[model samples]
Target: MPAMTVNDAPVMFDMDPETPLLWALRDAANLTGTKYGCGVGDCGACMVLIDGEALRSCLVTIAEAEGRTITTIEGLSRDRSHPVQQALVAEQAIQCGFCTPGIVMAAASLLRRNPDPSEADIREAIPNLCRCGVYPRLIAAVQRAGRVTRRRETISAAPAPGIDPADAARAVPAMGPASGGEADGGTTEPED
Candidate 1:
């Protein structure tokens, strides 16, 4: 059995040591946020934050992760208020949703290291591919997240009247079945 901390929670796995962390997280731990793109780790779709650094889970085995901390997209925040998450949401940086989690995680890790990274720096940091071709928006979101993070760090009490309270509040909606599409991406029709 391998012992590790995931999303600040302790866990032990009874699977083989060679099992990829992605499989361990999804199958054993029931954390589906860490996606599986290319099993060979060529794609960044399986990215996760290991000790505050972005890493491809598919290439990392359970035994290799022993005694280390892993953070999937789910663990980023209970209400999804992490600045990166908020910025992604604000910028509507998701489409198809297949690659969003990994991109978000990569951006998060970059922000953790460089809070005020340059545009070029963000471009270099987030090498994750999005089939949706939303890189421009993704960059904008990263910039927005940086601003939001800085505001939080510097602001003391109340934001100026001109500031959008929503940005400052970083409000997250309650988790449940939203009125859009089904869990399987099936379209939902409005009730008559």
Candidate 2:
């Protein structure tokens, strides 16, 4: 077993020491926000803050994480109020959201080191790929997050945790009721 501080809580992984940190977090610890993307570390979907740096969880083993601090997306903010998160929403940088967590982690780490990162700095820091093609907006979001962190701006876009149904529906248009006979528990046969 290897011990480490995850999300400010001390945890001892019961799995093999050689297991990748991503699996240990997702499978053993049941922290599913750390996604599994490109197991070879080319994709940053499994990015997490290891000892205050954004690193690919798929490349680091549990043994390598021993005696270190790991911060997953869940640990970043329980209510999605982290500046990076807020900025992401405010800038509309998230679409499909699969890579958002990793991008958020990388952005958070970068802002910690450089509170006033330029566009180029953001580009270099956040190599996480967004298949939704949000690169332009992502850069702006990072910059906005830095500003929020520095007290130069404020964002109210990130919804609080457990948003009510009305607010949620307003944020995203509600889908119309299920059509066809399914609404009444009846099945529609396939067309011949």
Candidate 3:
């Protein structure tokens, strides 16, 4: 109907208002993090935050989300190192990473609502399907992520917001001119 604001950017929905929010976000707004799962909202892969509430974007129509502040998984953090991601990585909860975004998004919603969620609460929050068989780890990760401890000492003062492959290579400590090894890109056999 009118212009909408998503992730602090204004956009106009020229198509019919009945268009699903997922397509509207992915196609029009270019927010692809909110993925397309089951169109009937059975799979929570399309879950997004609408005014702080988790909703299936595939089910929510543009008319429903008109002028609402919708936050996709991409909008969760500047980097993927958010607590959920860190815990998920720490717990080794991801496989194929298809269902994870939805589960993590749902768990993130749960954590925001209830900082200390129980096992049932965590499980109830994320009903999304995970064919990869990491559900236990997923649940545990959600728990661990909620009560994160930031290590000030280990954290460098100049933390990069996001890692760049090129920058990461530059940051590697220089190796002394020692004997060649696998890491030095040479065989360890003695010279002829």
On lDDT, the candidate that comes out on top is 2
What are the Cα lDDT values of the candidates? 0.84, 0.92, 0.76
* lDDT value, candidate 1, whole model: 0.84
RMSD of 1: 8.8
TM-score of each: 0.78, 0.84, 0.75
Please give the ranking of all candidate structures by lDDT, highest first, separated by commas: 2, 1, 3
Best by TM-score: 2
Instruction: Tell me the lDDT of candidate 2.
Output: 0.92
**Model 3 agreement with the true structure over 1-192: per-residue lDDT tens digits:** 645667666777887999998899899878887888789989888888888888888988898888888778778775766677778877889888777667777877888888677889987888888778898898778877777632311211223255565655555423334335567797766659
Q: What is the full ranking by TM-score, best candidate first?
A: 2, 1, 3
Q: What TM-score does prediction 1 earn?
A: 0.78
In model 2, what is the error at residue 121, expressed in angstroms? Answer: 0.4
Clashing residue pairs in candidate 3 are: none
Residue-wise C-alpha lDDT for candidate 2, range 2-121, written one tens digit per residue: 999999999999999999999999998899999998999988999999999999999999999999999999999988989999999999999999999999999999999999999999
Q: For model 1, how does the per-residue alpha-carbon lDDT over 50-167 read when each residue is reduced to its tens digit?
A: 8888999999999999999999998987566788877877787878889988998999999888888899999888988899988989998898888877785321222223335554
- For every model shown, the clashing-pair count is 0, 0, 0
